[model samples]
Target: MDPRSEELAALNALGMLESDEKRVLDGSSLVDRELRDLNAELELVAAELGRLVVPVEPPADMKRRIRAKIRSRGGSKLRSISPLALIAGVGWAAAVALALASIWLWRERASLNQQFNSLREAIAPVTQPTAEKEEKEKPPARNLEEELKKLRGDFESQKTALNTEIEALRKREADANAKVAQLVQEAQAQKERDAAMKLHVATLQSEIWEYRRSVMTIVWDASKDQGALMLDKMPRVESGRDYQLWIIDPQKPDPVSGGVLAVDDKGTAKTTFKSTEDVGDAVKFIVSVEKKGGVPKKEGEVVLKEP
Candidate 1:
């Protein structure tokens, strides 16, 4: 049957048996199958509905907000214009203003320059000073020592902070390296585990394939002893219940006796047929529980079959 038709039939059957789940089950099947068309139809419906939903006016306070912004800018522009006007004053007035400004600026510049010179002089070599010059500079030397001490303290504090930051960065780098190593180890282990699991699964699949290819259920031919079958592990049979082997024979009154066989956990069994037995038309071979020898009766389902 077509997969789609089978699926639809199952859904219809379920819906008929349980009416309540009908819409829940089938309501969105077509929609899911034609998602693009559904989305387009939804968009069209939304657009049509949007036309009926009129937009309300913006809040009245927004106009007030705009007007307030304009007024604020107007005030700012007026302030900015005052500086321009001062710059564009009459040339005579500007000259006089400039002259005063230069004098004041010069005074300030002279003061700053003097301060800088004094600082440089204090930091420079202290030559053998004359008595009066030495007396004049003694106070400044004391102040300079205090300034140098303050600068040194600041430098030491910054150096300590920088050292602390460097140590923290080193620790972070070490931790990152350690974490990377751990992840690498984990990844390697995971790869090994995955490889082992794949091998185990492949082995199981191969064994199953071999089991599927076998034709005969059981065989008992000692003449061609296919090497002594290894008896790795023996199954625990019940008391007085030994595994019996038999062969179907048309010439004989019934299936002929083969020999006792043993089964192991690996599903392997072995038995040898009697050499003198004609072994004619042995259409079937089987194992069963009976006396401590072969049995002529079957008391269990056929676990294996021969073509």
Candidate 2:
């Protein structure tokens, strides 16, 4: 049986398969005996889980919500963008990196034009021009400027989408954590290993830059032994310098490197980083400005950290 069929079977058992996925699984299960048996077993497991876990009651306003949704169905639906898409498209959606690059390029081109005009003025004094260089470049410059404007708009839209996704992810994580906490307490003795896993989330704001606001957030997934760092309104690092993250474990004496950051000019970055050593229940997280690639140990100026 195909592995895809196996997954669809489990989702079907839980009544979570979409209409299209249900069709695929139904067709596959007809021909795949192993997949059929797997589905049957999973359906039993789902039934048992349903019996063991208390079901949550629907909201009192569910009917009102349904009616509102029905009325809103006439309007075009908005697509839910994933934050991970920003990570993958890192540069363009990457704090609208292409927008920044394009702006930089536009400025450089404009500077070159100014220099060309100055040189032309210097030459025209010595020689009478038979033909003038018509302003043929003006149209291209205008088009480029228009493109930059569109990119800026796109950047704002992507930023808003990222913010919404981050909030939704946090809410889902909170719900899952609450549920897991209850289950861990109830079955700690039976499954101490699983119960030991944990997650940490912290938000830090800086006051050093009095003019602008800066925010940093870290989400530590203890089970995965990794963490993600998100920054906004941060100050751009100086030339030949980069921002680095440090994970401080109480068991260790020094902070471990959690990878160098690539922040855009506007002081925004999002990256997943890990330490050289195990981050067993991190005590704290620190951000600092380091040389180009980062150092083995934190020998840079500490800029932000958790209280």
Candidate 3:
């Protein structure tokens, strides 16, 4: 016999099955001998319980007392009675019925109570552990102060990092601004130097000297010890030779070497030269061909001379 069939047999015997379940149990009981036997035993037990549950009616005098109690509680008629009044009437009727049943079953009441207590004690161990486990699984409460302190520490760490990043950016911006300022200063100084050179060239052009095959122009600023040179129609030098300029100063015994000069493809050259020594009393200028790097002494043939 299947366990489900046995359960259905028990329900059917006690008259607790729905109409559909009752139909299924009746059909199964015809073929299942164990289910049929179990159903028969359950029916016998239910019949015995039905016999033990005696139908006790309230006496006439008890009914009159209940009506008097309801009237005193402001319920004049049954039709006008509230649900509470109806519940009170039912409770009183149940009490009277229970009193009569107890009187009739007084001999069995002690045995039944003893059996009920024994059953509760037997089931206590299984139920007690489950209640204790549920209590243990519940989460403990959090401390508000500790949680707030952790949040504040995290916020302070983030704020410090942010402030450090901001300071680094400020330093980088300051360095960039300083570099831009330096470039601006250098550009302004370059512009002033160019203007001074142009002015000096104009002054030298006013006092120019011309030679037989080439023209010479000199612009000397004794205060700064610098000058500009301009030569036109000058012959190009050999591969290992270069043209050099000499400044003849009355105070110096030897002519001071000005600098080396090179002619372009057009046989014209323009350059600025500065002397290491003072040339405050220069009286004449000369050009000579020398080696690629000019010599301190004029050891080459003079090509152009200026008064």
lDDT (CA) for every model shown? 0.47, 0.71, 0.64
lDDT of 1 by residue, 1-307 (tens): 2233233335454334244223322332322334334434444655576677779999989999998999988976766543324333433454564566557556755675688677657855766557876677567656655665665576567556655655665566677678889999999998776444321000000122323422122223323321122221234556676755455555666555555666655544543345225654324454445676645555543333333
The superposed Cα distance between candidate 3 and the true structure at residue 173, in angstroms, equals 45
| Candidate whose lDDT is highest | 2
Worst 10 residues of 1 by lDDT: 198-207
What is the lDDT, from 0 to 100, of the residue 267 in candidate 1? 45
Compared with the true structure, the alpha-carbon lDDT of candidate 2 equals: 0.71
Native-referenced Cα lDDT, model 3 = 0.64
lDDT winner, 1 or 2: 2
lDDT of 2 by residue, 219-269 (tens): 676777787767766787888998888888888889988889888987778
lDDT of 3 by residue, 1-307 (tens): 5445566677887889876557545644544456668999988987888877879987869988987887888654647764444455655655665566456445345555565456556766877747665454332212333444565576567556655655665566677678889999999998787556432211011122333445555655555667766666565678999988887778889888888987898666778888757876434677888998889889997777653
Residue 155 miss distance in model 3 (angstroms): 76
Residue 170 lDDT, candidate 3, scale 0-100: 58
TM-score of each: 0.26, 0.37, 0.32
